[model samples]
Target: MKHIAKVVELVESKKDDYIALANDIWSLAEMRYAEFESAERHASAIEAAGFTVTRGVAGMPTAFMAQAGRGGPVIGFLGEYDALAGLNQESGATACRPAADAANGNGHGCGHHLLGTASHLAAVVARDYFAAHGIEATVRFYGCPAEEAAAGKTFMARAGLFDDLDVALCWHPSVANSVFMNATLANVQAYFRFHGKASHAALAPHLGRSALDAAELMNIGVNYLREHMPDQARVHFAYINSGGISTNVVPAHAETLYTIRARTSPEAIDLFERVKQIAEGAALMTGTRVEMVFDKACSNVLHNDTLDAVLDRNMHAIGGMNVTANEVAFATEIQKTINPDDLANASRHFAAALRDPRPIIPEILPYRPDVERPVTGSTDVGDVSWAAPTTQCLTACYAWGTGFHSWQMVSQGKLSLAHKGMLLAAKTLAATGIDLVGQPATLRAAREELHRKRGLKPYQCPIPGDVTPPPARAAGTPAARASQDVIA
Candidate 1:
């Protein structure tokens, strides 16, 4: 506990530096696989703090790893800096307004700016603690990129980057603070491209097969599959390409990107195969050739109770964030822009946990060992969880009712309240890392829990062996244009 106090003090002392770094990242607002500047800043900061930095790991140019300490248990912390597309917003604004220069630019709507900074700060603190106390332990900080669209960690796991770690720690910015004990969905993403001959639609329609028709039919078939699949399974598609702009011209090429998610990896793979069959059927019906190009995939997270207990203990010891009245007023202003339905839903969801209605949550949520709420979303961290005894916690970095991937989140990303929450998370994570390193039994117990939960099956990369990471796209290119366009 004394060590934890010292770690907290160290983080507090360097608060301004971390805050400035977070704000700089928030301004960059780089997209997936294109976080060159954001990754460089973080790597430079960690390297300056005495951690050896390795850039471009796992075939991703933006991904990197920073490490300190040379001996005992190798404790790793995951950091993400990728921002969402089309969410550009002015900082600290209460109203819906785009960035002054770019109306539809990328933005850190997911609070990854704060997320990466907190984890990096935690790693820095852990590194310093090990040095000052002459303790033998390894501290690693992973600069994971493209978590928003691509499962970056899935590729990293396939490369065996996490094989030597004793335990992994992660945290996310959210509306509340609590350890994540729930399991996330396993998911697979792919682009289905169809090929056909183009012809004049009005003059010689029969001379050409419509690839756009194939895409439409494929979507219809997949939509019908909703009834046959498991209740928890989810299937979504986006029209990446609509063939051509002219209605009179029969389009020769078209593509649709699909994402399939389920409660487990096997289930998701099964559903993905069924979806592929539907695509084939659509191609047959339209007299077009279809090609399935795999993009990325990730496994479901294997939650470790031992690690969760450690995180929860540290969170309770650190206490809640100290939100000021001015910060509360700012949060109230941001809350006004949130949808009424979202506000109502959040209110009902946190009714038992919250004592009163407040825009900014200022309390640490109690950890529930029995709670197993299924997070419908997918994360690259799921793969890391499968590879190691990994666990993540969430801290309040946004207004209570603000939804993710929105202007409200981006607006509050650089505010003082967000900085406070980030520092709290850093302290909590550092404390947890220290505890794990001090007690090797705890790490063993976590590994045992992971093994028991995983059974006799070894960790398998969901993405096929032949499937490599997609190449990074040029700046200013739309995501659709960046995706692979396979024609059969």
Candidate 2:
């Protein structure tokens, strides 16, 4: 308890510094693997804080690791700092207003700005605790980028970055504060390209074999597969390229990005195979050739009750966030921007835990036992769980009804309420890391639980060996190209 209190006080003293860093990251608003400035800011801060920094790790320019102390019981903290595309909203505005520069601009709508900062702050506090107590435990901070579109941690996992970790801790900014007992879906993202001969539509219509036709037919075929797939399985697609705008000419090439998700990696692979078959049939019917370019994939998260209990204990010991009256007023205004139906749905969803309707959540929810609830969404953290025992918690950073990946979330990202929540999350994670370091028996129990659950099934990276991380969009590199000639 004394050590935990010291950690909490340390995080409290540095709250303003981290909040400023979060604001800086929010303003930069870099997306995906191109987060050079955002990553550098974090790396520089931790480097000055006494942690040795290693940059350009795992074949990623923005991916890096910072470490302190030495020896066994290595506890790692995962941080993300990628912004979503087209969510740029004016900061601190209650109304929907895009940034003046562009109608669709990038912003930290998913709260990764705070997400990355809180984790790093926790690692710093843990490192300070280790130095103060003369503890010989190792603490690491992972600067993971491109979590929005690309599975950065999945790529790092394949590179064996997390293999030496005894346990890992992470957190996300959300509407409620609680440990995640639910597991996220495993998914694969890819681009399906179709190529064919081009010809003048009005003059040589018969000579043209339209690739656009093949893309459309492929989408229809996959839609029909919905009924045959398991209820938990999901398939989605977006037309990345549809030949050209000239209707007078028959298109020669078209492409659609597809994402297939299922409860497990094997299930996702099975569904992906079925989708490929459908693409072949579409190409055969349209006289066009099809190519599958593998982008990336991530496995489902493996939950550990032993690790969850540690986080829950730390969270209770730290207590709830101290939100100010002005912060509450700001949150109340943000809540007004939400749709009536959304507010109603949120009320119904959290009715069991929340007794009264409020703009900001004022209490920490109890940790519920794992019921295997379906998360439906995907994250790169799932891959880290497979590499080492991992557990994550959520903090009340946004208004109760504020949906994620929206302008509303972007607006409140740097507010006082959000800062308070971020500080509390840092305390929670720092305390958890301290506990895991001091209690070697707890780490043993956690590792044994992870082993028992895994049994004979060992982890295999979901991404293929041939695939590499995508280059920045400005660099003009295609996400993935066919390894072999098109199957015809």
* Residue lDDT tens for model 1, 295-393: 888998888889988899988898898888899888888888887898766643431356465888778887777754645478889999888999888
Question: How do all models score by TM-score?
Answer: 0.96, 0.95
Q: Root-mean-square deviation of each candidate, in angstroms?
A: 2.1, 2.2
Q: How much does candidate 2 score in TM-score?
A: 0.95
The 0-to-1 C-alpha lDDT of every candidate, in the order given, reads: 0.86, 0.86
- Could you give candidate 2's per-residue lDDT for residues 5-29 as a string of tens digits? 7987899899889999999999888
Overall local distance difference test of candidate 1: 0.86
> Which residue pairs collide in model 2, if any?
none
